[model samples]
Target: METVLHTDKLTKTFGRLCAVNRLDLEVNRGQVFGMLGPNGSGKTTTLGMLMGVTNPTSGSFTWFGERATHLTRKKIGAVLEHPIFYPYLSGQKNLELNALIKGADPANIEKVLETVELSDRKQDKYKTYSLGMKQRLAIASALVGDPVILILDEPTNGLDPMGIAEIREIIKRIAADGKTIILASHLLDEVQKVCTHFAILRKGSLVHTGPVEEVGKGEEVVEVIAYHDDLPHILHEFRGSLSVKSENGKFLVRLRDDFHSVDLNKFLFEKGIVASHIVTQKKSLEKQFLEILQETTSHRQPT
Candidate 1:
């Protein structure tokens, strides 16, 4: 896959505070990449540097294998905070004006409007539209130039559930069309649902980066209980078990990725042990996210 964006030791500081620290990133084509973090974790600051709105204190970035410049930025469509439009202008008219500014083809206006599901409301004035409609129009403006890469910051920030869902669907559709999307959001659920790859940032440091699937599939935790009192011995003898600890009168066994609850049960059965209960607990992205934060926090604490 082609790298759409690459950063080398990107750093940004404000007085005594480092908003972004030696951050290295690689965003590939045809990927919906999510920059996930709590508020003030450099998500917006990083995006700002990439979009040229904020100057980096150090480091450099490249777009399409070339250093970031005005010409390079033109190849990317971005909405950092919010979109601005003339209240009196109709949605289509607003997009037309944006197309003119970007030198984009006028024909793409209708296509982008359709993509954002605003074709029906294209003639409606921007101010008269609902909050969701307004957000969609902002996305439409970004698409006016038919850029290959899209960067969004908190796309669903202040919206209700329905509006959030609407934007998510739009993002999914755009990603499906093979556009490289770099989104910064604090919403873990949204990233898990829409992003293929994600990086977790905590206090301006990258704590984790990997495919979304790997985030929640690190290890399988199995809850097992057996009728026999020799459960500890059986657990210790099970080669597939990574670790086993007694919790709430039941054994919580951590199994390797290649092993499952059934595998553990079979191994115990072959050793003359019968488990009365076996439950596999699949990890969630939120859980993994919290764990990463907790681990990083512990490491940062004074010893």
Candidate 2:
């Protein structure tokens, strides 16, 4: 895959506060990449630096293997929080104004509007449109320049479920068209659904980065119940067991990364124990995310 964006030790600070730590990241072309983190994890600050709106205190980034320049901004479209559109003007008019500012050909405006499904309401005044429609318009404005990459920060923020679904569909469609996307969102489920690749940040530092499909490939969790009175003690002593908890009269056992239910079953059988109930399930992205955060927290704790 071609490298679309690369950052080497990218750092940003405001006085004593390090908004973004030394971050190294790479995004491949045509991949829908997600930046996942809590609100204060420096996601916005990092995007600001990448988009040229904020300067990095130290570090460097490149676009398409070349140092980012003013021209690079033309090839990338972005929409941040609380976008401003002319309320009194029609949706079409607002886009036309935006296109003028972007130096994009006016001919592309209609295409972008249609792409965002706003053509039917093109003549409607911006103020009259619902919140979802406004967000779609903001996206259309970004698409007007025919940018190869689109950066969206909380694109579905403050919207109803239906609005979120609409924006999600639009993003999928855009990604299907082979455009690289950098989605900065605190919504884990949304990122899991929309992005092929992801990076997790905590306290302005990168904690995890990988393909979304590989999120829970390692580690296994199983719910089990045994007739033996010593089930809890046996579970704790199991070599493969990482943690065990009792929930709803069943023990939820988390195994080591390289261990599975088979290993646990074998060990139990050796001890002359047979489980009355056993159910195995792969760890979910949400679980993996929480575990990652927990591990980072533990590492940071004072000894």
Candidate 3:
């Protein structure tokens, strides 16, 4: 639980607009921390300030318990957007050049290529690789420096399902090796599956922050599907039912405190409703995310 990064009231403004306001965050070593928000919720601006590409208007940050500096920045590697590499150069050659620029040892190039699963295609020209391969190469380039932390913004943007799965696996692999990663993505599913902890940002302010596992832990949620048309109304009228939502031909019934799935099943039996499917489901991250946004809608500032 060593602190790898800390920000104190980090603020950034442009002319009359405040892009980021009084942001405070702490990331620990060996953590895959996710920063989640909409496109204009200051996720990118906060990352820019942390990476030294954009100066902060006020506040400060520290890396490895030391104040931000050139030396401290070297311990981190980042990819803010689509990476650009020489189209004509081979993937291996491109990584060599990147290592030189970062002052990383040339000897680490082969290991990083293997780490990103690009060893077989390392000799292929950068332009010849698919979109997925190009992205893997970018990650390989970032790992060549042997950084303690890696920062990625929208690492799976514009990729197919297969490509997204590949990147997700690679990220999990990196985290398994005890490297700290700060990932900024609007994809709630990605954060739920990959990150240990997450912070939700709304209108440049924090709305919620907590462990992904603890979301909706105390709530009772049950999924049911019945052929009868009156199933929805029946569920709504059931005792202890808080709400019922339909998705993909299934009804998710959330119950009040002390109400269990057994109570729901017993109620359905008494109503003579035969369910075709029934199971308890962990509350999904998407559901929780929407609820959080709805609760904060009135408190949001104009931006």
lDDT (Cα atoms) of all candidates against the true structure: 0.89, 0.91, 0.89
Pairs that clash in candidate 1: none
Compose the digit string of candidate 1's lDDT tens values, residues 1-303.
898889999999999999999999999999899999999999989998998989999999989999888777767888887777999999989988988877889999989888888999899889999877888888998888999999888889789998999999999989998999998899999999999999999888888888897765667899998888788877978888889999998999998779888899889889888788999986877888998999999889957
Query: In model 3, how large is the Cα lDDT of residue 97?
Result: 93
Better of 2 and 3 by TM-score: 3
Task: Give stretches of model 1 more than 4 Å off.
Answer: 223-253, 264-279
Clashes per prediction? 0, 0, 0
TM-score of 3: 0.85
Best by TM-score: 3
TM-score of each: 0.84, 0.82, 0.85
Candidate 1: residue 82 lDDT (0-100): 75
